[model samples]
Target chain A: MDREFRNNKPDMFTVELFDATSDLAESLAHSEVIMRFTNSNQVLINDQDAQRLVQEANELHQKLYAKDASRDFMRENFPRYRELQNQIASNPVLQEQSEAQEMAINFLREVNQEISQLLGIDFGSLTRRPDATC
Target chain B: MDNLTLNEPEVASKSRVMEVARRFTETLAETAQYRALEETYQAFRQDGEAQAAYTALQTKQQTLRMVTMLNAVGEEDRLALKQLEDQFYGLKSVQNYIQAQETLISMCQEIGDILSDAVGLNFGLACRVGGCCG
Candidate 1:
């Protein structure tokens, strides 16, 4: 039996589903939390001082985790990495971005909860790709 | 930057976000994939033979749980389990149910990808219960 329901051309129902998904995405993107997140992200990106600190921390993080890095090397660089992380965390732009991101995530979770409630399944878990690490 | 607050009047209210989410869920319910999944599941539930086969398989598996875990199942027990599995899977209702589920999952994965792209986050991963760390 040919059981495949999908084809190269989607049916009207599939088109409607996609459109609704787009509308939801648009609403979420325009929501205050997401808007704040976007704005804060922009601010963080435009801040040269924050970017430099982030870059420096990232480079140190890579070195610390490198296969050839000795225990002594790790010990020497770990404190500096922590200090750089502290500086980045203290930056107002970065702080706002972090908060905004957290808010956006919470909002999305709430939305997912609503969807799951109506559908009688965990939408996120069902939709998650098989290869996804998480 | 001043202390960021989510209480601003300019932000989209939670009610509006929920409304859009409801719309998305309603649209998803209308999709062919979802409809097929629902119908097949109902059919599978109503299929006495398929349900009996599944119950038999599960009972056999439970009976052999300890032996199976230790890889010490006797040949007769193993063959019995295999036969039960085959019987359960051979049912048309079971096959239809599985196919419908796969199609629905594929549709959901596409939607997840779209939402992830639009929201600048892995929608499925973020909304997952317990999340990546958990």
Candidate 2:
């Protein structure tokens, strides 16, 4: 009862879902919008927009990959947590279990909501970019 | 008495029967596996070691291909193992489950068929933009 759900989080699960959602966004941005990769030089898909999708996508991909490393901490410790949760499932003192479980649920909800928002924007207007031949 | 007897087209009769059988059997199997996968995801989401084992599963979900969506069914199963702490119905919403799965098999496969002769890779992960997306 004394434990705060948000204090200890399941950051790994959040990162995993985030990474997956970002992948879809990256692909769409590449083909439909940014179009291709560039380094120092910027290329245009046609006349107006810069074809730097590959670079943008790579940046996003790198961010996702970097954040993904946090999962290692969760991956390393989740088993012990489960073991404790199972052992204490029937116990009248659920303060600790409740705390841990709540933290996880909240973390997942945050990730789901965040990824949903990201996809909503990327998929909505960006996906509908006017069709043009490059 | 013979007035009730209707002559059926040769292809029509066989096709109708086959369709009916496929629907019944596929629905049953899909339901069972879907439920099992849901449980597995729940279990895994709550457990970390299982989550690590499922890295391949996670990668598969995000991979672009015509069938990536279809391939994501397996992701649901893997998620069950990762050890999330959320409170959810042991049973997922039937409509959501069906829609997701249906999209995987139908949309993914259809997209794959439309894009290439092959059936795997769903839509093509990372999609490089090395060649024409269309």
Candidate 3:
């Protein structure tokens, strides 16, 4: 028998049962994740992680410059990439020489903190849930 | 109906993992990199302000160099977003998979309830009649 037939054509009882079960699962999962993310507060990206990320970004920047036109698909996406790159390159938050790295870290910290509040969820709860993480 | 396996202490089964992977692959490919790059490139290529700004960097290089730099920056942004999104994609995929299964489980439970109700009402009658009176 067709799968849809088995599912969609179920008698009224089966339909009601499926509806109740699916609703419970959705609610439970959503609640679990929401609580977890709320509890975990904000995830901290240490200097090391920040450094690795920035280094990777720079490396990617250079490598793309080196690629031949036909070899890479950069042509497809150069415009918005340029804007983001310009933002990184020009932002006072990112441009400070003596405090640039620290500034970046602080900026990210601020952003993450704001995000935490915006999300109104805890990180601890996120981890406790079976597979929920943000 | 789906089983509740997210809370299981062990590793998720391969099928669950695969389901998550498939869900993210499309999001990862489109939103994270290719689409953004294309948009950024258009901004850089079409706007005078963008051109003037980029020309500073462009002047230092030959035509190929300029192309390469734009492409380079584009690639850099794409990769950065990709890495960031990949991490997010991974986390969300697991969460989503678990959530989806939870939904299925709930559905199954509802189905079970409905079956029980029907049996209470008619299963005995059906057995007695046997389609056309066995």
Best by DockQ: 1
The worst-scoring run of ten residues by lDDT in candidate 1 chain A lies at A1-10
What are the candidates' interface root-mean-square deviations? 6.0, 18.4, 20.3
| Interface C-alpha RMSD, model 1 | 6.0
Q: Model 2 chain B — which ten-residue stretch has the worst lDDT?
A: B113-122
| lDDT per residue (tens digit) for residues B1-134 in model 1 | 24455433344577988998999999898878888999999999999999999999999999999999999999999899999999999999999999998888888887787677656677888887677723
Candidate 3 off by > 4 Å: A1-134, B1-7, B13-19, B28-37, B58-134
Q: On residues B26-83, what C-alpha lDDT tens digit does candidate 3 reach at each position?
A: 2322332223344444544565644453444344334346556666646665565455
The digit string of per-residue lDDT tens for model 3 on A10-129 reads 442334333432332222222322223222222212334434445666765665676564444566546545755665565443344224323322322332233234434221122122
Q: Is candidate 1 or candidate 3 better by lDDT?
A: 1
Candidate 1 reaches a DockQ of 0.39
Which is the better candidate, 1 or 2, if ranked by DockQ? Answer: 1
Better of 1 and 3 by DockQ: 1
Clashing pairs in 1: none
Best by TM-score: 1
Model 1 per-residue lDDT at A114:
98
